[model samples]
Target chain A: MKKILLSFFVALAGFAAHAQETTLAPDQNPRYAESRDRYIKAQDQLLVNMNTTVQQTYKAYDWYEAKQERKLQRYNDRRERRLLRAQYGNFYSPYDNNYYSPYRYAPGFRRNGWRRGW
Target chain B: MKSIFLYATAAILLVTTACSRKVTRIDPVDTPDISGKWNNTDSRLTAEELTSQILTEKWIGDYVQAKGKKPVVIVGMVTNKSHEHIEAETFMKDLERSFITSSKIGLVQSGKKREELRAEKADQQTNASVSTMKKFGLENGADFILQGSINSIVDAYKRKKTVTYQVNLELTNIETNEVVWIGEKKIAKNVKN
Candidate 1:
């Protein structure tokens, strides 16, 4: 009985050694698998941080750009109108009621004399 | 009297047409900067110089040799903190274009565009045929991200002002957070009013 029990224990040890020689399931190596998972989680978090940073930076940038665009448009339009008025005297149109031009049809109004007034 | 009327008509016609807003097309290269603020030439030339500098750095070679592939890059935000309204997007696009044309690095979309791409993919998942639908989590992640700022300093006295714009860009490794390359381009203009 003792010899049979000893042989049975030896056989169990051999099976355990064989199992070790064979590839273990991922779950069997909890330490390595957990470390790997942690690494991946850290990496994913890093990437998420990176994306968030980029998005926030661009959000501010885009807001400023649009604001600047509107401001520039306003400035440019005003400047262009001022330039047009300077280059050519106030535009007069007969059909438009909203046309409030400084130069109305004066029978004797001289174009060159307007400069002399200044 | 007939000749006087004809001359009057001719003079009126000439006056009506000659002094109105006249637009003459000229080469953009020939277009001089009327306002000494940041302009297209500054953006284009800065991108060209920085792209060349970024590519020639040791980090690119190290990454290529270690990874056995070209580094994928995504251009992030370039904040414009200049005295004038500088469109940093144009400069960013110029940099992206130069990177692509160089064929030395891979480029990926960032910010809203990337979100748009992901949204499209999500839509495709439900709407498209099973065989034709794109898979999720298949994006080639960027290995490096380039971000920067455009800053300026202005010194003015009475009618004369000197504006100096400094464009500083840095490329950082996305994985390691290592700044691989840093570049700066300075453009200055003197304006007199």
Candidate 2:
């Protein structure tokens, strides 16, 4: 009976050793399922943060660009308006009788007067 | 002898415990510091910046003669060829809004405004019992159509990965298939265990 009990104990010890050898340590074990889940969560959070940052930066950029653009547009518009005014200011309608100045007629009339007196 | 064995066992246990306790310190999983001044290379506006740069170029500006006329633009499709599912619409909308707010372009809402005008005219004709209602059609077609695409490539190792994204855009004439403008942006990111 004593021999039988010793054999049984040895068998149990061998079985336990085999089990330990087959099993992996906690850290080394495949927690891929769990790690994958965590990774997905982390990725989602990162994406959200990235999107928010992008939006904010884009908004700020747009604001700055808009302000600068408005200034430039106003300046250009003013310059163009001034140019148009200068170029078209001396223009007159064809129907206007005073299209030419009266100085030329003054000289011609004087010559005609002298000829008439002669 | 029993005391010596006890001491030896304690010593072995202490050594094993110390070896097993390998201080991992979990130092907050080094995340990418997306906060600071990032280059336009890694930014979302890379494509837009490039496009704007192209637009501002003296040659393009001179050719377009768009100086006098506000840049009238129409947003078209943006195809995605990236591995990850990304919405191109969001970025396109941002660009459209930027153009509108900038006032650099006389943005005409495609069909929507014309429809509204037609409805108004129809209502007027119904009320007045007049056949002399003004017919409204495509009063304005877009001078330029903006189209683009997004593509990506990825490489990965054991808990380490790299992703690259590329965005390209083009402006084409409505009457002609000529590509009047071209723009591109690229971004790359690295992640590790």
Candidate 3:
């Protein structure tokens, strides 16, 4: 009876060793397969989110810059015209020939040295 | 026999536990919400566009005040101090466009424009009769020079980040060195994982 019990024990040990040596396929291992799938899905979602954020951020910056550009352009245009008029006198009306022509000033104004008086 | 059974049970439990801990595939339900966070909050403009806008606002106002007189304007070099590579030329162009569109200030091009003008005048003098081509000097200098800088800061963590940008512009009297006007724009962005 003792010998029979020993033989049974050896058999059990051999069976356990054999089972340990066996390798289960990934698909067969439900826990491993599920966890790996979850990780992959998470990675894909993360990528999509990252890409969307980048595009949106770029667009936002672009819009803001464009608006500001328009504003600055308007300001500069007005400023330039003002400066031009100041330098050359208003171009809207014909130049006063008398005011501009050195030879057409008040009669005898240049001859009598009376330019300073005016 | 009892010991063998215990050893077998322990081995199976260990294998199951190890297998259960692995991540193989992701669930569709847990997919990230990319659309929710995706949005264009800030817009960008080319340098020329920006310059035009600035010029239009200040130039028109100044022109109206001067009563159709072209006021002298000196556009100074814009400085870029931001984290990204930015050209101040865009801002300058916006200022120039504003001046040109409004017909308010006499906007002078920088050294480059002046050189080009000089070369053209020289060519006219040599290739064409002096009498036919009018020789004119840039009579108006900038009465006011506009200058400014851009700056920014970024704060970030794992899969999340924040950025802040600032633009500061100033108009100053060239002769007196007095600041007449100051314009500024600030932008901020937040990103999540």
Give TM per candidate: 0.60, 0.41, 0.42
List model 1 lDDT by residue over A16-109, tens digit each.
Answer: 9988766567556646656667888786344442322231111222333456679999999988877866544455345421234443333345
Please identify model 2 stretches exceeding 4 Å from their true place: A1-118, B1-44, B47-51, B58-60, B63-68, B110-135
Deviating ranges (above 4 Å) for candidate 1: A1-118, B1-12
lDDT by residue (B1-193, candidate 3, tens digit) is 9999999999999999988866667654355545222112222333433454455566447545765565667565555565565555544555566667766567765554655676887788778885776476745666777766666676655456666777677778765577767766677767654
True contacts kept of 1: 0.03
Using DockQ as the measure, which candidate wins? 1
The iRMS of model 2 comes to 15.0
Clashes of each: 0, 2, 101
The residue-by-residue lDDT of candidate 2 on B1-193, one tens digit each, is: 9999999999999999988955554333343355222332244466366547544645345434745555566665566666555566555555666666665555555324444666787777667556756655635667777767767766655455566678787877654567877777777777553
| Cα error, candidate 2, residue A37 (Å) | 55
Q: lDDT tens string, model 2, A1-118?
A: 9999999999999999989766766666465557657878796343332111121111222333456679999999888866753543322445322323232223345654222211
Least accurate stretch of 10 residues (summed lDDT) in model 1 chain A? A51-60
lDDT of 2: 0.58
